[model samples]
Target: MNRKPADTEPVTNAPEWTVSSLSGALKRTLEDAFGHVRLRGEVTGYRGPHSSGHAYFGLKDEGARIDAVIWKGVFQKLRIRPEEGMEVIAVGRVTTFPASSRYQIVIESLEPAGVGALMAILEERRRKLAAEGLFDESRKRPLPFLPEVIGVVTSPTGAVIRDILHRLADRFPRRVLVWPVRVQGETSAAEVAAAIRGFNALPRAMNGPTGPVPRPDVLIVARGGGSLEDLWSFNEEVVVRAAAESAIPLVSAIGHETDWTLIDLAADLRAPTPTAAAEKVVPVRLDLLAAIADLARRHRGAMMRLGERRASDLRALTRALPSADNLLAGARQRLDLAGGRLVHMLGAGVRRHEARLAAAGQKLARLSPLVLLERARARWATAAQGLGRGFAHGIERRAAILTRAVSRLSLQPLRLRAEAGRERLTIAGTRLANARAARLAAERARVDNLWKLVESLSHKGVLARGYAIVLDSEGHTVRTRAAVSEGMALELVFADGKVGATAQGEGAQPATRGRKRKSDAAAPPPVQPTLFGGGE
Candidate 1:
């Protein structure tokens, strides 16, 4: 304890260290010792990017742990950012923070430790989206039975588009709208999502450069088979969400049958390949035509069966009905018996009326006017003396009446009255004749107007427009080409007259009656390409 000045041997010369200098020296030594490390450890203590966009986290294994830092510039360039509890491989320089005198790894790059890490991230995302009900069966819609226009989201030059086009052409040709996009890489998810929304943004029907740009009734998001990382674009949340929210029914054909992606869950239907998606979108044209023909045959057979049944019933009813002669026999017999009794009944009625008339005449004779005349004569005799004066007064009154009649009577006045009556009769006759003539003229005009209306409304007026009515031998309309056959009798009624003709053959094409226009020979519309460009 007392050997400080002379007892100890002379100490070797050494430089003094300040705290900062010492810390700096240690930092340099750590950096020099482990210039860069490819450390594999589980990421911990990562909340997120700091305010300055730097990331500070810890890398820990079961045996040990170290502080790790990703600077703002390096973090921005990282493809995979550090997540808490994510096992990652970090390549970085090891140095000490002089202020705290602590050593940390300054990471330059970071990636998942292995495929297992990527799977972990994928499963976590799947669970999150599933919890939000994005992958529910109820949310999935049915693919259109036949999409007139099919929208495809895929690479423009890939075999997938060609296969889909070929398959669709083989089954049922449909107009295809291609939205070319990158199938993989950093920007794949965004491009694919934008393609889906862009398709949805198109009008249901609109005119484009060549023709109509009809919105797809159904969509196909497709790509050839590839590894999980290659197909990871479809599994991205943005892609999955776009598929889930699409109004158009979506079919996902991302990979081979064994391969699947998040889009497969979100899509309305999933196909093993692009060709299979084409098959699901439309039915075979030939098969549809065959089915329609079969239905037509069935309908005709049903109608014929019904007609035959109705005819048989009618025959049976006709046989059960009585003849007209049989029904009228009893009525005829009753009418003959009544006719025989009519004369006797009329004679009996006449005899009863004659007896009633004779009784009335006998009563009238019993109350005759001779009895009243005799009584009147006896009364007149008793009043004869008083009547002498009355008789004289009557003679005087008759003489005065004769004198007045002679004074009033005049032939000239009578003749004038008769002439006036004749004039009035003549005017009345003229007026009656005029009224009759006007009535007759109005009736004749009405009849003429009605006849003109009938002529205008007749079917002959339609024939006057250079059209002909074709009638079969049985006077039925031969409306369709199928109804005509070789040696079939036909009647063509034109404006002036009708002509009878025979059909030449089944394959004969009806000649065009009128002159053909130049536009009738114009070329057909151009075909649209199956794939569009602009893919990366």
Candidate 2:
């Protein structure tokens, strides 16, 4: 790859050049070479903008330095003025003066490089912290509007502490716990983090008996305006994380209006300056008083409106109301009429109810069961006497007939009947014996046939004849496959004896298929025979 020539290399190789010409050439070359360049260095001698609308400054570090200038137009555009020891970026053309044989940059635009670089770094850190959900809006805590005890983390003697105290005193006159800490240099961030943690560790009820204790309701991390490097401690990751992780809400106020640091992004709130942070932390006394007066005025107005509405309603209601004299007169007339009617109706109802009660009592008296029963009992007694008489007469008639029957019987007739009875008994005995023998034989045959039928129908007989009669524990015959499910114990009755067996899967059949013929499915399902035979 081809490379470009170095800037230090001479443009032309000529030997007939004078010292002044060489210097002029070098100055021109330098101007051409370094035009519109941006250089970063620490500000050493920064002169504030003059009436000529120009700023003069010298940027230097420990090892190297440069002279810089910025026009008034550019200086006016800066939000924060440059100060000595401030680091800055100078965008200008590098030009050499032949008289002094020195090169300097004529700045068209100037910015504090430290602030820009810090801003860039803060932006990057913000993105990373946001990705980690540390700077998420959801993670941000709302500051208490009326904090009982406000905590301040700042330098002990700095303007930030004084401003916060004055503002807090003016706004609420509440005790602010100033956790003194360095606001700059190496130990500032550590001290700030420790102060935050310390406040957070305090018990929530630390406020005194009559007043709210020193538990910080809100934390203010503040510092006065300074160079970027002077304020860099607040931008440290420890400080940012501490502020971000604080249980109490944190407000970051570092440097001036143009300074933005990583701590600002991590904190719940960011204020431009310490005084501004204090102003944000609490309401101004005058503003609060004015607001209270305004609210009181609004409240009074609202009450007046409400009272007017109520009065209007009352007027409407009064207009809608009936006249008291008329109403009372009408009510009196109604009451008089009602009283007269009520008296008449009550008297009539009483009379009517009395008559009805009298009639009911008479009817009840007429239907009294005691009188009816007495009468019935008398009739029953008469009927019973008549029945007794009839019974006596009937008994006497039967006795006469029996006595005549006895009189008609004679000894000769009795003897002939006795002889005839003996002959007939002899003949009856022979016939009875023959008939009994035939009947016994026939009964034996019938019993044998019945036994045969019963045996054929019996579950024991079926099991003996190469058929199995399975029954469940309840003695219900297992007719269908499903009735004899696997793992079921069954009674297998044979002609001679009975055996218990369990059904395996192979012998089970679905009950649904045999549901139609369920009645004839098994041999009477094994039933407990009663002594009298089948169940009644």
Top model number, lDDT: 1
lDDT of candidate 1 over 1-536, digit per residue (tens): 65576757777779999998899889888889999889999999999999999998899999999999999988866657688899999999999988877888999989888889988988888999999999999998888788888999999999999999999999999999899999977678889999999999898778989987889899999999998878878888889999999999999998899998989998999999888998999999999999999999999999999999999999999999999999999999999999889878768866865675576556545433333334434554455545546555654665466446545767466446545644664565566557656755664464445445545655677888788998765454566675666676789989999999988965545443223223322323222111111111
**TM-score for each predicted model, relative to the true structure:** 0.54, 0.43
- Model 2 segments more than 4 A misplaced: 1-123, 170-172, 207-213, 301-309, 324-536
The TM-score, computed over Cα atoms with residue i paired to residue i, of candidate 1 is 0.54
True-structure RMSD, every candidate: 28.5, 26.1
lDDT of 2 by residue, 1-536 (tens): 97777986768766798879989899888887876788888777876777798887787878987777777777665433566666667778998767877777787765556556556555665787778877777878777777777888888886678887877777667668888998875467778889988889888776667765558888888888877678777766778788878989999988889987888888899999887877787776788789999999999999999999999999999999988897899889999999999999878966865675576567646544344334444665575567558656765675566456556888577557656655765576566557756755764565455456556655566667787666665454566675665666679866667899977778765334213233542223233222223421
How many clashes show up in model 1? Answer: 0
Local distance difference test, each candidate: 0.80, 0.72
Residue pairs in steric clash, candidate 2? Answer: 53-72, 88-113, 207-212, 207-213, 481-509, 482-509
Q: Which has the greatest TM-score?
A: 1
How well does candidate 2 match the true structure in TM-score terms? 0.43
Prediction 2 global C-alpha lDDT: 0.72
